[model samples]
Target: MTEEIEAQSFEEEDVEFFEFKQFNKNALSVQLDTDTVYPEVIPPYPSLLAISNTYGYFVAATNEGFIYASTQDLHELFDNSEAGSKELLSQKIHFEISEGKVRCLRLSSDQLTLIVVVEGGLVLFYDVTKFASEKAGCQPFQIMTFPDDIRDLRPNPGEKYNLIAILLVSGIVYIKDYLLNNEISKIEGSKVGERFTAMCWSQKGKQIICGNHLGQLMQYTPEGTHKSSIQPPQELQQHYVQNVLWLESALFVVAYFPVIQEDDSELDVFIISRETKSKTLYIKSPTICSQISSDHPKLPYLYMETIKDWGPNLKCLIICASANSADINLIARDESNNWTSLNLSDTTRAALPLSEVNDEDTLPVGLALDFTCMESWITRLTADENTEVPPVPILYILNNECDIVAYRCFHKDAFFVDESFSGMSPPQKLPVTGHSSGMTLPKRDLSHSTTSTQNTTVLSAPIKTESPITDPIETGSPIVAPIKTASPVFAPIKTASPVVAPIKTASPVVAPIKTASPIIAPIKTASPMIVPTKSGISNNSLSSSISYDKNISSQKKIRTPPPDSTPSRNLGSNQPTEADSKTPHMIRMNATNNEINELHNLIEELENSYIAKYHDRTTEQCFDNPDAWLIGDLPVITSEINRLEHEASSMSQALADLRRQVNEFSHDVHIDYVKTTKDIEHLMYTPSTITVGRRGILQSRIKERLETTFKVGCYINFQRLFVYTNLYLCL
Candidate 1:
């Protein structure tokens, strides 16, 4: 009973392990709409997608031949913020291909060049940095035309030269220096029915590994010299290799066997050691096949994370997307280097139901794997002092229905802390370092201080009293600076109340100070008499007083507006008048009117040009014959219709003739078959009719019958049949 219980627990643990490794489809998903953000029209069926390595920016192409490059980080789609979503939807670069629809897009590792493959075997090389910064102009710096359509282009991983491997639809590979516009070498498939289906460059770009439809992996140097080849094992014989990836010591080959039922087809992955040229491991996975034709087969997308310190052998998780299903599979290796796979079809179905009327969507059209964004997201999610956060790739799957779903391939529990441990310790507070973080001090009222200083300076300027002004000093304590006397005659006196009456009655002195600058000039000239006699102020207070005095002196230097301009200043500060507010409205109205006039002129020009051209063409056509004008090209249309009818009649008559000939041939064959069958039957029945006696007579009769029935060119053997009949009669 205990053993059974332990086995059940082990099974449950295995279930949990798979649950954690599966992709969480519900975490993030967003549908892309071109109309919402861009002025250009992009159809719903996006054909190509390419993502950058640094920022999570991507470029997408539509079937209508429109390509859009995003300006904002695609990772913002995870937050679901309105502003970020809007920014992410907006495109910075728009390119229209006039040749044909874009088939493939490859962004270089350094993110410098963007390689675009269109129909008709045209390859365009664009300067991504220039177009992205300029935000205008859709011209490629370099264009190369090929004889066949390009299947894929891979930039070299080495930093030696700007070299790229171009794979054509006819199973030919070319190593070219795109910068120099030179073809270095060309690698062609074998003459005995072998063609490359998928290819990848080595780590240092020293070699290229290509997979063919015959389940063979071929390696070649950058100079196009054949290095080695690895054939598939017995179980994977006659399989079509879909993709090949070389990571460190192992070469991963993804191959699938063709079957009538696509759903029953198994995807096989073989891991081979590059050093020994031997197979190390094999894996089989069930996958849903796409409805695409075999003539233009698409290889599965494979992404492997940069292996760190997981193990001595292959250690990173491999993510594969075959573009045949909405879900992806994760192939990982444990510490023991054992390979295992987990499928996320069930999770995807649960998250995105296919039964909903509007939710009916196609399989993934493109897959983008980003490790930079996923690492940052994992860091933020597992910020609660958790160190065991698993490294997973951030995969963005774009479907035909314009929806982009993000997958993390791991459970949230890996980044979640237990509730029991959460309450054990309080959250640590981050140290405040900036000035904006600490307590704020109240602002000093500089306006009020300046007004009080002006009043003090004016009152002391006109006063002729011998006693020093000390009564106003107590009232000005809030003002940091002390007041100065206008003359040295009253500098020695310290009486506080002698000038109180004069100061109150000196209202007439303010008029001159406000009207004439010469009367208040003593305030600036008496700076030597403004020394502080009090010793109770602290150093801070004194420093603040000096600053205040400097501010007051600076304000005095500024030219103040006259009283005559006070009404204008008041009108500016208060609500605007009718005429003042109408100024901007009038300007806007005039600008709009100008724009309308310009548009009207442009439309009129276009209309006149079109009418003139139409009239000219019509006149030219009617010049030769007057009847052509009245008929308006009816005879041309009739001729086209008659030609089509004649072709159809000829095709029908030929088909009838072929049918009659087939019938005549079949009749002749049937008559010959009946004659041959009767001849063979006559030979067998004539022998059986002979009795046991009269062996000589029977032999002579059988020989005579065989010779007459079967001549030299007859179907039956006369001599053998006669001998057999004679022997039977004797017995």
Candidate 2:
């Protein structure tokens, strides 16, 4: 019965909890429906997106090769129109590309040039202003095509030169000067089966770091020579390098380790030091999605941006889409030099103003395919002086369903409000009457009607009334609305006035209370009790007497040493004093000194005995000339050294002969290996040398034997027939 009751209680709690959750979810949905505004201007099936920093406009490419650009700023484009309106659609300017489907769209660092990578390894460059113009059709000013399909292209970070790095479908990369239309150099993969998946140029465009499918990072100079290669750690050996980014002295590498179960795959980010060629930090995320059909499988998109003033050790923020889910992971380097992952959906739900839901299981499902950030939307002041405030960056994500979602990135303190006046009471609302006749009512003061409590003090002002207006039958008068006046600022409440005063008495004098002040007076007694003083004097005598005591009774007495005594020796001194001669401690010290002297004498006697027994020399002689002992064995030592040198020379000669023989043997082996390889190749290519089945060979041999047997039998039969005929003729 107890168990059943407990179960019933648990069920009741669960039901209540679920009902609360459902209500909150519904409220959140309604709030989102009212707050979120979807723009109709975004084209369907957005494949590539690029924002212009100079003009504050954005261009998006569809899967059908249609390019759409907003005529005005993207922020204004959505703000000026209502949801489901065709007005925004008309504001968008579009042009179709005949080249092919767009693969990538990038704006030059100067924000003046637009680089478009389309199908068939074609790179088209056009002016940003012209692409977004009101014209119906627009063409690229320059076009460069490669024999192989282009994988990725990056313009040099330096605005001085028009250099571009082009990665091809084959593992080859080309560094070309777009202005001159000439190839500067080409970089190829070092290993046979290695293919580059991602490539990024250094900040200064001095070096390029490329990640290959073999989970290795290769660094190359702009001059086309390989600089160095970094292999992934042992644990990440099975993972493929998908993306690589270079910042300062470290390389950020993104690797994907796919499992048999696609949902169990993980994405790893390695922060490798350039000088040490070792990993300084590593981060991993489970359930990172990848394109199975891609030759170099990778996430839908990976983006990175430097976070300014976030923290001393923050470094940068990495945003990438997670696999089999709609959320993106915000991986950042924390102060502890470790990566922390934050799901975008959870963050958004937690940051919602209407709902307090933060359950991970309730996260909305929508795969983030691509996202871009616009930093020029709004500027915010930082704490530093003499520095320009950077604009707040706004993130725009394109999900798998081709819907655009915008998120505003603001500082955590941006929404903070001052609550200094929050303790004050709010003003009361005024009562209103129903409007029946066309007559304006005069405004009256209601502050006099309200009364203050004993703890609070209220201040009243003179009441002012306005004249009422009357409407005639021909002239109509407008109904006057009540005007809300500002509430009077209330001062802090004062304490209540004193109720009683103490009576004056001669024996026990009472202190007079100030009537102007509201502080209560202290009580007085008829006869005062005395508080004993240290000198044992009464209060009346204390004022009259002026005698002073020569000495304080609280002072402690200290003894003074006689001047005749000699000054005591310093505690750290090693010399013995007169006092040390009379104590047992001095006797012990004398005994220790005597024992030490006896030990020294015994040690000298032992040494002398050892010298006399072993060397036939005095101890003094041994110490004075230590080399004398080695003089007798010098000739033996010299002979041993000579023998060792002879052996070493002979060994060296033998080693040289062995080395020569090994080289000859190796040469012969190489020749034999080459000859055998060629023979094997020849036999493999020759049709006649092909192997025949054993059954076929046996069948051919049997057929030959049967044919021979048949011929011989026929000859024997004819001979028998002739003999038979001759025998018959003779008869």
Candidate 3:
């Protein structure tokens, strides 16, 4: 959409920009390795959970090597005092350089800390305050790792932060605390067997429910005793279980497969009784899966809803967003895991970004929906304290107030109105003291964007908007910062010295070394201002942009158009105006006016009006009215989007291919290097009997005279080479 808009307003838009970089006396100096390409690191928008209303923040990792923290104050990250050319946040990688692409992130209710699970199965406990503090940067307190990639992590709702369930590829669940003060216990099934992708604590808090790679959703005692297997739809039986949650007395599960071509490719949510085994299928759409959640744990009649599905294709996903859209839906679930909603239309919603397209391009990305709707992903749902209603079920429905299905609550109304609560802090800024130019991380180029906008805005807007619908952060080249040997370091293993291998596949612990503390640079007393990644505009310094503004300044620069019509508010209000229906560029000039604004805002109103008004007209007519846009069915529409998406995906893939080629080329070079070394060693150890002089004539004659050596694997059909047997020798 940005690209397309750029083209549309190509002549009119004053393409503006701002940037931050190394220009100070302490200049941001790189290794100056011209021969080596720097690793690209695109930052993913991460969610953090800390001791609410405390002095901390948690930065979640992306599929790439970067972590992100949002402001404890929502007003900071989103609604800054004003808009600017570049949007900056205080949150950063607590210690700099992500352990790897983060797989799952969970913030305990305390909001004081968070658990970060990276790709390749590494877990790190981050102290959000250290980085956010005006004094110290966010730092790591502990590091615990596993062999294979981590699947998911969750704290027991039944326990007061006493235990957390960690899922690993080894098919074991580790129950431990963040403090690691206790030993880790492994949980596995007694009857059926396999790794579990999703887990949930029963309402009574005595039982646990889990979902596996194969859609085997089942219940068990908290003590690890296995119970009955809750059957899934026959078609979805083999699908990977994404998430499981319990509402009151029921167990709800959702699972789907990677392949979206068949009818069974969609997400499936099933509700089953722990005792009776009576079950129902809430949603069976090929492309849409239902999600269950509740804000109603503390209130009645007010239900939280949610849904899960791939937005465009397997590449992009639609998760529940705090702000709603028209792409996906949200629903409700109970402790038994059964979805029990009165209607689907009344459900709230959220959105999440997915891959650009379904391609093999090596990019790191992941999303976890709220626990209320943690069907296709792992996310725990907690209500916003600002709401007066306690435990109101936040039914984030999948459909747009259309075909509704199952709904229920997890904790019940009694769980609501927990007065003891803490609010989240904004993101923290920690210096990356250990970032080294070693490991290769794949990332997108923040410096450039295409001028095309072919299928950008054609998404099926969901009722609830997750994060941005698009993968805003391009997973870039691997981060190869020369490791500074940051402290709190784990015991490094023998350096595999992966000279130039796939970073993803490179050994986790490659260097063996004693732990050392980071060499601290002068700590910036003030918060670092927002620095732009591109064209130089922002002064990359701590004292310049970030200081609290004394007056309303930044956002005033953004030009907002005027409102089209004064809206019809309450009874006895003024009648509608003629100009309202026919306005061109409607803007909300008066933010305070209740009479002029559309109920859903212009974005929603314009979109709804466009579809309702122009969809039935001829394409030629629709094109004339800029207000109306083009849309098609899931298949036809997505097919076109697939084309544009493939175009962008090709670039990512090409980069991956380039990296692969580099690794291959490097391997070849290494082999040649080894062979050269060996030849030299052989020359010195068993000095070649025949020594050639600097002049070639005598040496050629002497070499010709000597018996020719066979080249292995080289087919020498040379009839005259009787002395040679092998070809293409490592000789």
For 588-703, candidate 3 gives per-residue lDDT tens digits of 31221232223326646666876676445644444445455444333334555799899999999999999998788557545644443444444345434534442233334323
Per lDDT, the best of the predicted structures is 1
RMSD, one per candidate, in order: 36.0, 43.2, 33.5
> lDDT tens string, model 1, 112-217?
6778876656666766555544454545655555656677778897774378888776787888766544556778777644677678888888888887777777
Which lDDT value does model 1 have at 43?
A: 22
Model 1 residue runs over 4 Å out of place are 1-28, 35-47, 66-72, 81-88, 259-266, 274-314, 343-359, 374-393, 409-731
Best of the two (1, 3) by TM-score: 1
TM-score for all models, in order of appearance: 0.47, 0.43, 0.38
Angstrom error of the Cα, residue 367, model 1: value is 1.2
| Candidate order, lDDT descending | 1, 2, 3
Q: What lDDT does model 3 reach? A: 0.35
Q: Cα lDDT of all candidates, in order?
A: 0.48, 0.43, 0.35
Total colliding residue pairs, candidate 1 = 0
| Candidate 2: stretches off by over 4 Å | 1-47, 66-72, 80-88, 132-134, 259-264, 274-306, 311-315, 322-325, 343-391, 413-731
Model 2: per-residue Cα lDDT over 91-153, one tens digit each? 455555665666677766665667877666666666555543435465555555555567678
By lDDT, the better pick of 1 and 3 is 1
Clashing residue pairs found in predicted model 1: none
